[model samples]
Target chain A: MERIPILKMGKFLIVSIQVDMHDELALALQEDLAEQIVKTRAKGVLIDISSLNLVDSFTARILGNMTAMARLLDAETLVVGMRPAVAMTLVELGVSLRGIRTAGNAEKGMALLEAIVAQQAKSNAPKST
Target chain B: MPPKVRDTFTVRSDHDVVTVRQKARQLATELGFSLVNQTKLVTAVSELARNMVVWGGGGTVRMEIVKNGALQGVRLTFEDHGRGIPDIEQAMKDGYSGGSGLGLGLGGAKRLVDEFDIVSRVGKGTRVTITRWK
Candidate 1:
């Protein structure tokens, strides 16, 4: 079985989708990301789709599901680098990708993720009385 | 002028779905469709092709380069001989799904293209034909 590589960077996991993923591959990525989140105790997951040209409802649903799953596991998932054409198509296709955060590119996405993690840490920090 | 070109592909597995999307993208690009139009057509193809693999239990897709007057376009026909849709009206709704999908396949695909037509018979199969002009 083929798998998309998930790179762990400190408290974040980055997945760059470079292939035209099939249905099974997308599902596998979802499951694999969940397991990795638990194992690594990661705080954020960044999915870069700049190399992908199209995102159908099936893929969109998987992405949406991934974000939901990651949320339950206490992680933030940010999908970045969507092509302008793909974004137009997604809206016309009526897949809102609800509950999923997005950024223009990986750098911006990373910065946003850092901010989110920092915010979370600040809130989670115990009072030093 | 060149004659119309038609090609057929089988949609039996997940890989086939990706192939269909690629082929559709190629055809749309060759027809000089704008980038956004190409994406929309390819995305629509992805949805319909996956429908054949997941719900229809495999099928065939026919890609045709069509011309009308001076306009060029790509037309695709997806046929599947699996369990046919019982209620197409409900299935076309955005939130309706007979399987584990977002129920946006048919309606969404239709929205992305310029022309859409569907024919289905219970206990038989379904055929969807769509076209996008450039």
Candidate 2:
């Protein structure tokens, strides 16, 4: 797994989460982040939670909400690089995923997002016109 | 918000939720719940406890272990007598926060546990109970 530093790719909200994010703060940020993505009509999103310590119920809910909002705006969200301990803590805290997809790292998430774009392109491409 | 506690567990701060979480987790484990399930229950309890303190104006995290037949799961009731919820349906909406603490949101907590119910009044208080059964 290669370390992919956070960068703005094309048109998407790239949030590199840290370990000390308060649950409320995270939730507030998600609202703004999701709104920005929707307002801009970004392609997709990559949330890097590699440094998160414990994603409590509130934080998890925000992530879940973000996923829903992104979908409403026709954008995909991929949670990337969640630590196993943090993930388990979140599970214990009963953080609902709300059907948001997850990935091992940023590289894979980006690749998957790009794949979706490619697939959409092929499907929507004109038939030999 | 303010709530009068009748029995077990005096909740002073939000951390008192740790006790509720500990007790609930143990009970869930004894009932043969998977580790994952136990964690979810604990988290739900924590949320309720926080709500009691934050929105309900600091009440109590009552832990009731019913030894009666047909009802075996450990039940946690967060009783708070603060300004009750004005609208439950709106409160359940995602990102509907109108308070000081993490919004003391109910939607996620409700989603985490097997059983969840709440009762409240505008000027009375709020009581939220959740249980996880195996």
Candidate 3:
């Protein structure tokens, strides 16, 4: 079976969707990411979708579900690198992708992730006294 | 006027849905569709093709380059012999899904295309045709 690779980078997990994925593959990724999040105790997930030319309703739903699942697992997910055309189509298609953070590319996404992790760390830090 | 070209693909599995989307993009690109138009058409194809495989129990898709005077467009027809939809109006509503989906496939696909038509019979089959003109 084919699978999308997930790389663990320090406190974050990076998943670059470089191929046009079928429904099963997308679902598999969602499941795998959830498990990986718990196992790696990652703080954030960055999914790069710049290579995907299309994102239909089903794919959009899976992505949304992944975000929600990550939230449940104590992690934040940032979907990055959506092409302009895809963004236009997704909006017209009536999928708001609510609750999923997005960025223009991986650099911006990673920066955003680092900020989120830092904020989390600051809140989690013990009292200085 | 140039001769019209038509192609057909089977939609039996998830992989087939991806293939259909790729083909739609290729054909749209070949017909000089704008980048946005191509993406819209391919996205629409992905929704409709997945519908056939999931709800329609697998079917076939027909692609053709159509012309209306000065306008050239790509038309796709998705047909399935699975259990047909009982209420198209309900099905077209956003957030109304029969399965584990976002229930945006039919309605979303319609918004992405220039023309849309659907026909179905309970316990018979369903056919959806969509077109995007450049």
Candidate 4:
């Protein structure tokens, strides 16, 4: 699966997931996602996996790679709306999601991104005397 | 003809995934799982099927449905006698992935299913079981 580029919304970007067939779209999206990571200078990313059903080890690896790539671009990645069984199956495949932020749904994921961005901006901005 | 009630199908292959997927959906439907459950299970099976074809080179995939059992769901078992993972821990970690698939890796596969389990030996084989319930 090629990387799937993310869709931007303010400081947050949402990446669409093919879910069933991830190769062509997923990989292609990654280049776009990498580009966004740098261009947007966005605080965070929300990968919407709601449309996907099956993700092979290769697909899973790309996801990890994309997230790592995102981090290098100074953007945090959050994987959202993963079905319970998919989560379990991934575990058996010997993969875990430790660093990446996880959200149950897109709305909440976007919210989390907004909060993080707000906090970062607040900390960076000098306080008025 | 339709498969018998609560039937199980097991196959070994190195160049087929569509067949497994079709079989998985058929059983998932016969078992009477919700759309959510069916999608998850089908997706989960797809991951395992791909793994069996790729990493394992060739392996076995078993599909079973537990209609009246304690779980009342569907189960898939994928096992392969391929080169087992060297660093199971790191492999399972979120950021670490070895295959050419998705960055999500095994972690992503788990997220699509309901219940998942695995046991692997250095060279013996890797057995992964995933189940989706009502």
Candidate 1 error regions (>4 Å): B1-5
Q: Highest DockQ: which candidate?
A: 1
Q: Which window of 10 residues has the lowest lDDT sum in candidate 4 chain A?
A: A18-27
Expressed as tens digits, the lDDT of each residue in A8-125 for candidate 4 is: 7877778877544434455677778877778878778888887665545655666788789888886778888887766765665556655667889988988887787778789889
How well does candidate 3 reproduce the true complex, by DockQ? 0.86
On a 0 to 1 TM-score scale, where does candidate 1 land against the true structure?
Answer: 0.97
Between which residue pairs do clashes occur in model 1?
Answer: none
Candidate 3: interface RMSD equals 1.0
* A108: Cα error in model 4, Å: 1.7
Docking class of 2: incorrect
Encode model 2's per-residue lDDT on A27-126: one tens digit a residue. Answer: 5676677667756778788898887644565567677877887888878889999877557756534444759899999899988988886787798889
Q: What lDDT tens digits, residue by residue, belong to model 2 across residues B5-58?
A: 324787756456555666666666767776566656766676677677767778
lDDT of model number 2: 0.69
Higher-scoring candidate on DockQ, 1 or 2: 1
True contacts kept of each: 0.88, 0.12, 0.90, 0.40
lDDT of each: 0.92, 0.69, 0.92, 0.68
Error of 4 at A101 (Å): 0.9
